[model samples]
Target: MEAAHGTSHFLRDGVVMLGFALGFVLLFRRLGLGATLGYLVAGVVIGPQVLGLIGDAESMIGFAELGIVLLLFIVGLELAPARLWAMKREILGLGLVQVALCGIALTAAIGLATNFSWAAAVALGMPLALSSTAQVLPMLQSAGRLKTPFGERAFSILLFQDLSIIAMITVVAALSRNPADAGGPPGWQLALMTLAAIAGLIIAGRFLVRPLFRLIGGLGEREMFIVAALFTIAACAGTMELLGLSTALGAFLAGVMLADTPYRHELETDVEPFRSILLGLFFLAVGMMLDLQAIADRPVFVAVAAIGLIAIKASVIGGIAMIIGMGWRNALALGLLLSQGGEFGFVMFAQAQAGLLISPEAASLFGAVVTLSMASTPFLMMLTAPLRRAAQSTEQREEPNNDGAGALVIGYGRFGQTVAQMLMLSDIRVTLIDIDTEMIDVAGTFGSKVYFGDGTRIDLLRQAGAADAEALLFCLDGAQLDAGVLGAVREAFPRPKIFVRAFDRRTLIDLRDAPHDFAVREVMESAVTMARAALEMLGENLQDIDAAEQEYRRNDDERLDAQRAAGDYGAAREMVISHQTELAARARLRIPGRPTNRTGAGR
Candidate 1:
């Protein structure tokens, strides 16, 4: 292909890809379904074997691979090594049970029925062992099951499952035929290469990448920070590819090493846009690969496969959850949540195809199964909530707290402490619940009433006056905690004016739309304090200060409106800063008094 011809082809390919992305984004937003599914649907629409609008998934797959790297990086950044180890009972014990037992049992049955070789069946089973991270996490988060004991256990197992995906690539590579070469590197060499790639990533991460990011960050160029993140991922992956190991493994290693770095969160924030695009493309590509024709030819086979896969997986997971001390409701929820095949299954299937370990038809069949499983998860999660409500209604007899006339606060962190202290001063009577032992101790020392307990625990809620409390406040920062506490409170006292704290704009939107009577940002108090200081420094008399502050708030509302219009965070931050500065100047010009002393402004 000539260079110009190649360039033209690339541009054409890019346009097709962008069209798929745009369509999915709109569909996802409109349907209240996740964008991941939309991407898959788009892939099916444009895929060559289907509409033939987009032929050859090679280029798109490459970008989608980048998405996988970013996704794992974000996961690693959140999952610290110590925390992973702390959840070993779940990650190792329960996780191994979920993956290995399910894999072996499912494979044995499939192999026996289809009369396929054990190897091919094993290959199929390996993919089935994986559960969709894209599907499961979002559902759990939306349903408030994320921080329940079941949620933590499920998350830990999923984390291990994610890491195991990279390992699966290596396993498939090793198992593949060498063909004419018949002289590929020995097993030891391959193992050494994998180990060396990992060690190199750790060394580079600790001694190199962090410092480079710090230097790039100092340049005060956000674009530079973004570039630095991309470079780190690509370079690390390329290095591992050169070492005859999986690029995904190398990228994951780099992420794990940087998990504890201060810049990890910033890196995650910076890479989100790219991650979304890449992940969307990946799902779209997977959708394109679905064997629609095969399903058409063997509709019965596909239907039985889908139904059988879900039923078997759900049953196995429920058994495991029950064994692990999950309540019946939680056990059922866990089973439903994990009954789907995850994206990593596609990764495994790709490696299998490249290795010639599985026939093309088999690969396509497996892909179809995985995609269907993922798509069903949202509906499954929706079902879980209604079922849980029914279960709760049938089980509970009477209100736990007949004497709770006070306000109930879940979480005794900074936000919770402030609210409790204010309530105490106002003599409104408050009951505080927290999972943090230290916070409970501190609250008691300060002569504040608090209980050390998980807010998600129904018994704990009862002890904290859930029934009689006039209001409920959730000051927890984690989404899982917030949702669980909210659900528990709602179930216990359906009529309370539930107040909650949100950590970000998305959370705020969710909270505002939620069935809460009041929703406030965790930082709103700090914002008020800063506003007071700014107004005092601007030489405004108390009377004029109040008016200016109101105007400032009004201006902020307008600024936020502009920000959502722009659809870019960098622009939004700039607009906010500009508005604050401009309003301060305008307020100062209108104020009657001279500038206040720094002490008076509490500077």
Candidate 2:
């Protein structure tokens, strides 16, 4: 009876939490605030400090941290190996400088303003150098800028911040005031173990993980994909935890391993819901743990310190961005966008407390400071929209799927499959797109990579390489092609030779004056082949059959031309071959003709 009542309590709490999240998130977003803020605000309202409805936020944080881990994994999926390598300069140069300078400056501020020793300041300040990836990434994505160059720059900095966690932890551990932590691994030993673990994960991803996913893909079990994706994250995260490394880092590595493959979109789709819910829960837990009483006791100090941290980090980062040749506007926007304390700050503070460097109250106070700084970022960006807009004009737009392909075939059905394979046979690089997930799964079984999306969407096509492709093949099965879409595609991506599939003679006629370079009636060639075979079966001479076929094609072309001009399927009825003319043709070919009614129009 007790266990059942406990379950009922959990169920009730779940309802209340999610319901609050739904209401507040919608309201906050309506007020131009982001969902993270909404979730945080919602948690605060229901938390022990307020309504006292939800308790034990400290325990909730461990589970909610998976949201962060999954988020890193998703971010890693966006960074293919080549893309990561391409940002090496930004990651090492700009990112390193931002973290180092920000950490130092914040450390000094803490030391000067507080009673804490230099060791505690270093332990606390370095982690604050990182920004909230969970909050900022969604904002960038919602605004459709996550793939832009400015976004890339922001991402590079964040990646380095994530990479710096290990070093930060090492520093905190080495400065440990606790005798228990003193016997823990040294910095050098930890670094070596991190490297070894990373190598092992890479090797496993290549040899074991990828093959497992492939087997699952071959089986075409979508539910199993969700299962496999979750397992991958869990297994990798568990390994890192076992080795005293960041579980988020392990999930990130797993995502990177699979990023270059065709299954990324599928994995992303499957794992996204979990990431969203858990991440919201993470922010909610963060709010519940804000220690409002601690902040209320020293409100002015918390508020001032939070503002100072934002200013220092923004100035340092903006200055670095400018030094790296970003426009001043973009530089400033980038600075403000990343000018908040990160989720990792809480973890680092807890670590400091564990090392006996700071008290729980000190950690809670700093955590409140971080939260307030984070709360201010949305408003800052909203007020600074002009700078971002002006700067974005000078930057390159997103190229999400620029795979250096020469042809983009926009359907993977029978027709698109043949068209794509022929291009491949001639050694042309091609990117294939279709809206069918089942087909994509099956295609993976045969080593064919088909992206899932509506190819008719110009944005999707552009991402699939339409701009750079030498040819655009619209091989949709039905009369899905039209003049307006073709014309729009031609104007938007004039570099590609647009070829469309016409479902019938009528569809061909409808598109006769469209902007496409070519259109083939889906059944025209097969009909011609069938006519030739029937003539051969009748023992007609090859020479005469060829002449008859040419004559028939000439009439068909003339009638199709007339129909296109008139924009009517029934137009040019007089141009079709009559029974008398057919009889004359039979006489000329020396074949008997039986009197019969003429067939209707093939269309």
Local distance difference test scores for all models:
0.71, 0.84
Worst 10 residues of 1 by lDDT: 396-405
**Model 1 lDDT, full chain set:** 0.71
Over 4 Å off, model 1: 1-20, 28-32, 383-385, 391-603
Best prediction by lDDT: 2
Error of 1 at 260 (Å): 1.3
Error of 2 at 452 (Å): 8.9
**What C-alpha lDDT does candidate 2 achieve relative to the native structure?**
0.84
**Residue range 1-603, candidate 2, lDDT tens digits:** 999999998898889889998999999999988998999899899899999888878788888989988987887787776666888998888889999999999999899988999999999889989999887887887777776788878988998888787688667756777777467787567767777988999899989987787677667566787798899999998998898777877898889888877667667767788988998999999998888999889999899989998999999999999998888999899999999999888878888998789999999999998999999999999999887888877887744334368888988998899899999999888888776656777898998978755577676676556776789999998988888888889988998899988899888898887898888888888898999998788666787778888878887898899999899999998766787777666676665543243323331
Clashes of each: 3, 0
User: Could you give candidate 1's per-residue lDDT for residues 440-512 as a string of tens digits?
Assistant: 5566677764544455555556544566677788778666434445665676778668887778655554343
User: At residue 408, what lDDT does model 1 achieve?
Assistant: 78
